[model samples]
Target: MNLRQFEVFHAIMRTGTVTGAARLLNVTQPSVSTVLKHLEAQLRFRLFNRIGGRLQPTPEAQALLPDIDAVFSRLAAVQRLTQDLAGGRLGTLSVAAAFPIANGYMARAVASFLTGRPGMRMALQSLTTPQVVDRVASREVELGVVHEPVGSTEVDTELLLRSALAAVLPATHPLARLERIPLAALEDHPVITYLPQNLFRFHVDKALAEAGISPRIVAQVTVSLTGIMLARHGAGIALVEPLMLRSLDFPGLVARPLDPPVAFETVLIRPRGTPDSTVLARFVAHLRDVLRAEGLLPEGH
Candidate 1:
């Protein structure tokens, strides 16, 4: 009828005698007898026959043993799986991120993390800033990395890095000769930019607006990689973060710092009330170390 009764029945079937079953179960003989009687009553079928002061398993008990053993085996597997997860020995991490961090920073960080911790697995989803926030808020992802400033009270964010934005231009472009491209110089050029909905796009637009310059929008792309490709083909200059610049090896594109440089802040976000697991914390640390080693993070940060 229940797990305990099934266990008692199994013990009695294996040992044949009530006293032996009681010893196997670490229970009194009377308790074992009581459980067997209750189980037989609930099932409306006798599981064993009493003969010569011993339990002789019935045909029904023999038929049921295989099914009961299977159930116990599955339950044992489930218990082992939970124990592995709790010990941080085996698990999957679901991570979401905006374009730059997803493709640039987190990709490499995840690689290094997995290399060091082979028992762990990760699933990465690339999304826009809004999507990252939504995934984290909905509990679809365990963690997120994004460029936008997260203001949700239901999420906790930690600043990871403030990377300087670079002006990516075609190799032959005259502005490419300068050590840095001033915002004013880009006023007349068609600007191949990220989609307006993206965080970096918002930052670039605001910076240009503050500088009294409105960029001529030549093309808008959803991904930073697309923006880079467009810039390489001479579509127009693109304002992208330094990490994205490093990731691309476009032959015709050169990345130069923006004059009076605008930097975008990268933040690690998690649900407000949830504590980060050991695996997640180790992953965050790996990310910070990678960024710092690559000269993306602020000094001593």
Candidate 2:
């Protein structure tokens, strides 16, 4: 029998009356009766018996109830899953981000995004900018967040924000008393910063060159997080991006803007032709809200 006929027969067996079946199926009683008749004709067996103005399930109906119940149970589950998917409440997301972004703002964004999404499982990986770009290009991750420019033509990039580099120093350090640290002031003091090969270092070097002093480089770190940590523990002063520093709580450290602010672009990258899903769209909106609250986005954004 077709699905409609099976549905009507199952509903009649469930409530044991055509009137109840019609109400359950949102159909007229006559339509329900007609479907049951058609189903019986197809099956070559009566599914119900009329007794004293009431309907009773036939022996054949009693035997088929278990299978019909299972079918409807599965259909009910499918509907619930469909609703959850449409609502952006169910899915798996894979994301890769640069070390600083992961340790700072993206961490906060994920916590907020997953607040009520019990069905959305996610993976957040920390990688360098090149690694982040590679992951997105190869489709190993759905999205990548990094503070450096990505030259890959395999992905689409969107600049999220431009953030300034600041000097982080131990609270007890001499530079800590200054509201803004000039690059020249750091010339004689030991500094912990990006490796010369890194893209972020390019901006810092150019800014320092304009100040006409070479930084006294003691240690070079790949991630801003490492430099910040080092500076917190009486290490050399750190010149690094401040995006991740917004949420930091290093009791012994304070971050001061450079006299000439050095800025870098933070971008979100995705595979070129990737189609958007409801869950991904929801997460992007949630992420922007987090950035706005972090003061990383325009107030009206």
Candidate 3:
């Protein structure tokens, strides 16, 4: 029998009479009787018996009651789950981000997001710019944060923040005396920064090439935080975006805006045509607020 027939059968079994089943289902008694007759005809057996004007379930109807109850139980669970998702009360959000954002602002933003979201879960992974793009485009991660100007056009991208590179140096370094360090000044000292494969490294290379200057290369690191740490130990000067500074707590390190600023953009990405979940959308909103307050996100956001 169909779902409606099963529903009518279940109601009749529960109340044990056509009049009571009609009342429970908010239908006329004659309508309930007609539906029950059709249901028994489809089943090719008698499901109920009318004796002394009282309806009694047959052995077969009693045997089928458990399965019908299970169906209703599962349906009720789906309804509850749907309500939770629509109300933003429960869901898991998976996000992939470049190292700087994952360690810095996103870490704090996630802590703040979990304050009252007891049933919500969040997974944050640190990856390179290209890896972030790949994960988002492949639908492996619902959201991505990375350095802007992503190479691929398969994902939807939005500028999340705009900030210039910062010059990180040892507290005792000579450039620490300058409010803004010029790129040419770095020529005198070894530079510890990202490896060439990184997207941001391309910009650093272009800027140096345009100036017709070659800075001493001390170390090639994977992320800005690593470069900053090395600079704190007097390895060399480190040039990094400002967001990277938020994750560091080196008391012996100093930061200055690069002169003739080398600006950069942070982008938010998602797989093309993938709809945003309520939980994901809420967390993204929270992230933007935190970045804006930290002065990472641009104004008029």
Candidate 4:
């Protein structure tokens, strides 16, 4: 029988009366009777019989009930899944972010957002700004978070926050005693920072150049996490983005503001000409809330 007829049969089996089936299906009693008649015509078997002025299941109907129930069960599951997907409660979220955020704040955001979402799947990637731009431009990922200024015009960008790089040093170090450390004060100290070619490193370099101070560079690393870890190991002072410091507790390390903050913009880069995603927006909200709570992102600005 067709789905409509099957639905009527299933409803009657559930309610045990044609009038009750019509009420359950939100249709008229005549329509429900008509569908059951057609279903019986196609099957060439009576699904119900009149007994004591009420409808009772036939022997054949008793055997068919199990299979029909199973089919309707599957249909209900399918409908539920479609509703969940349309409501943004179930789906795969493919996302990418720059190093510090990917390895740091993004984890907390994803974890908090995914709480109790059993049907949701996540794919998180960590890459440089150039790599993030590539994935966004190719639509390989739904969202990419990066620190500006990225030069790519292929993706639409929105600012997440304005933050800066800071100096992290051993707690016992002399620099840690100061509330803010000046770049020129590093003339004699060993400094660990990003590689010379990195975008964030450019800002630090410019600040140093404008101040005409060339600190002793003992180590050059890729991500801010690396610089923080190196400093934790007595590797002089680390100049790195301090966003992750909120989540990372290095007992031996302490972070201090730079004399002149090396500022940067955290941004969301997404595929151009695409529809907006509720999941992506919710994830971003979780990310910003985490950052704001940690003081990585200032409130209201």
Model 2 over residues 135-239: C-alpha lDDT tens digits? 999999998998766888999988878778999988788888999888889988998999987888999888988999986788899888889888877679999
RMSD of model 4 against the true structure: 3.2
Return the top candidate by lDDT: 4
Model 4: which residue pairs collide? Answer: none
lDDT of 3 by residue, 90-178 (tens): 88888988888898888898888888778888899999889999999999999999887787878998878777878888768788999
Worst 10 residues of 4 by lDDT: 275-284
lDDT: worst 10-residue window of model 3? 240-249
Provide the clashing-pair count of each candidate structure. Answer: 0, 0, 0, 0
Looking at model 4, residue 140 earns an lDDT score of 96
The digit string of per-residue lDDT tens for model 4 on 153-213 reads: 7899999888888998887998889998887888889999999778888898899898788
Give TM-scores for every candidate, taking all chains together and pairing residue i with residue i. Answer: 0.67, 0.87, 0.71, 0.82
Q: Model 1: which ten-residue window has the lowest total lDDT?
A: 240-249
Residue clash pairs of candidate 1: none
Query: Can you list the residue pairs that collide in candidate 2?
Result: none
Better of 3 and 4 by lDDT: 4
Order the numbered candidates by TM-score, best leading: 2, 4, 3, 1
CA lDDT of 44 in candidate 1?
96
Error of 3 at 36 (Å): 22
In model 4, which regions exceed 4 Å deviation? 37-46, 87-89, 182-190, 210-218, 276-282, 298-301
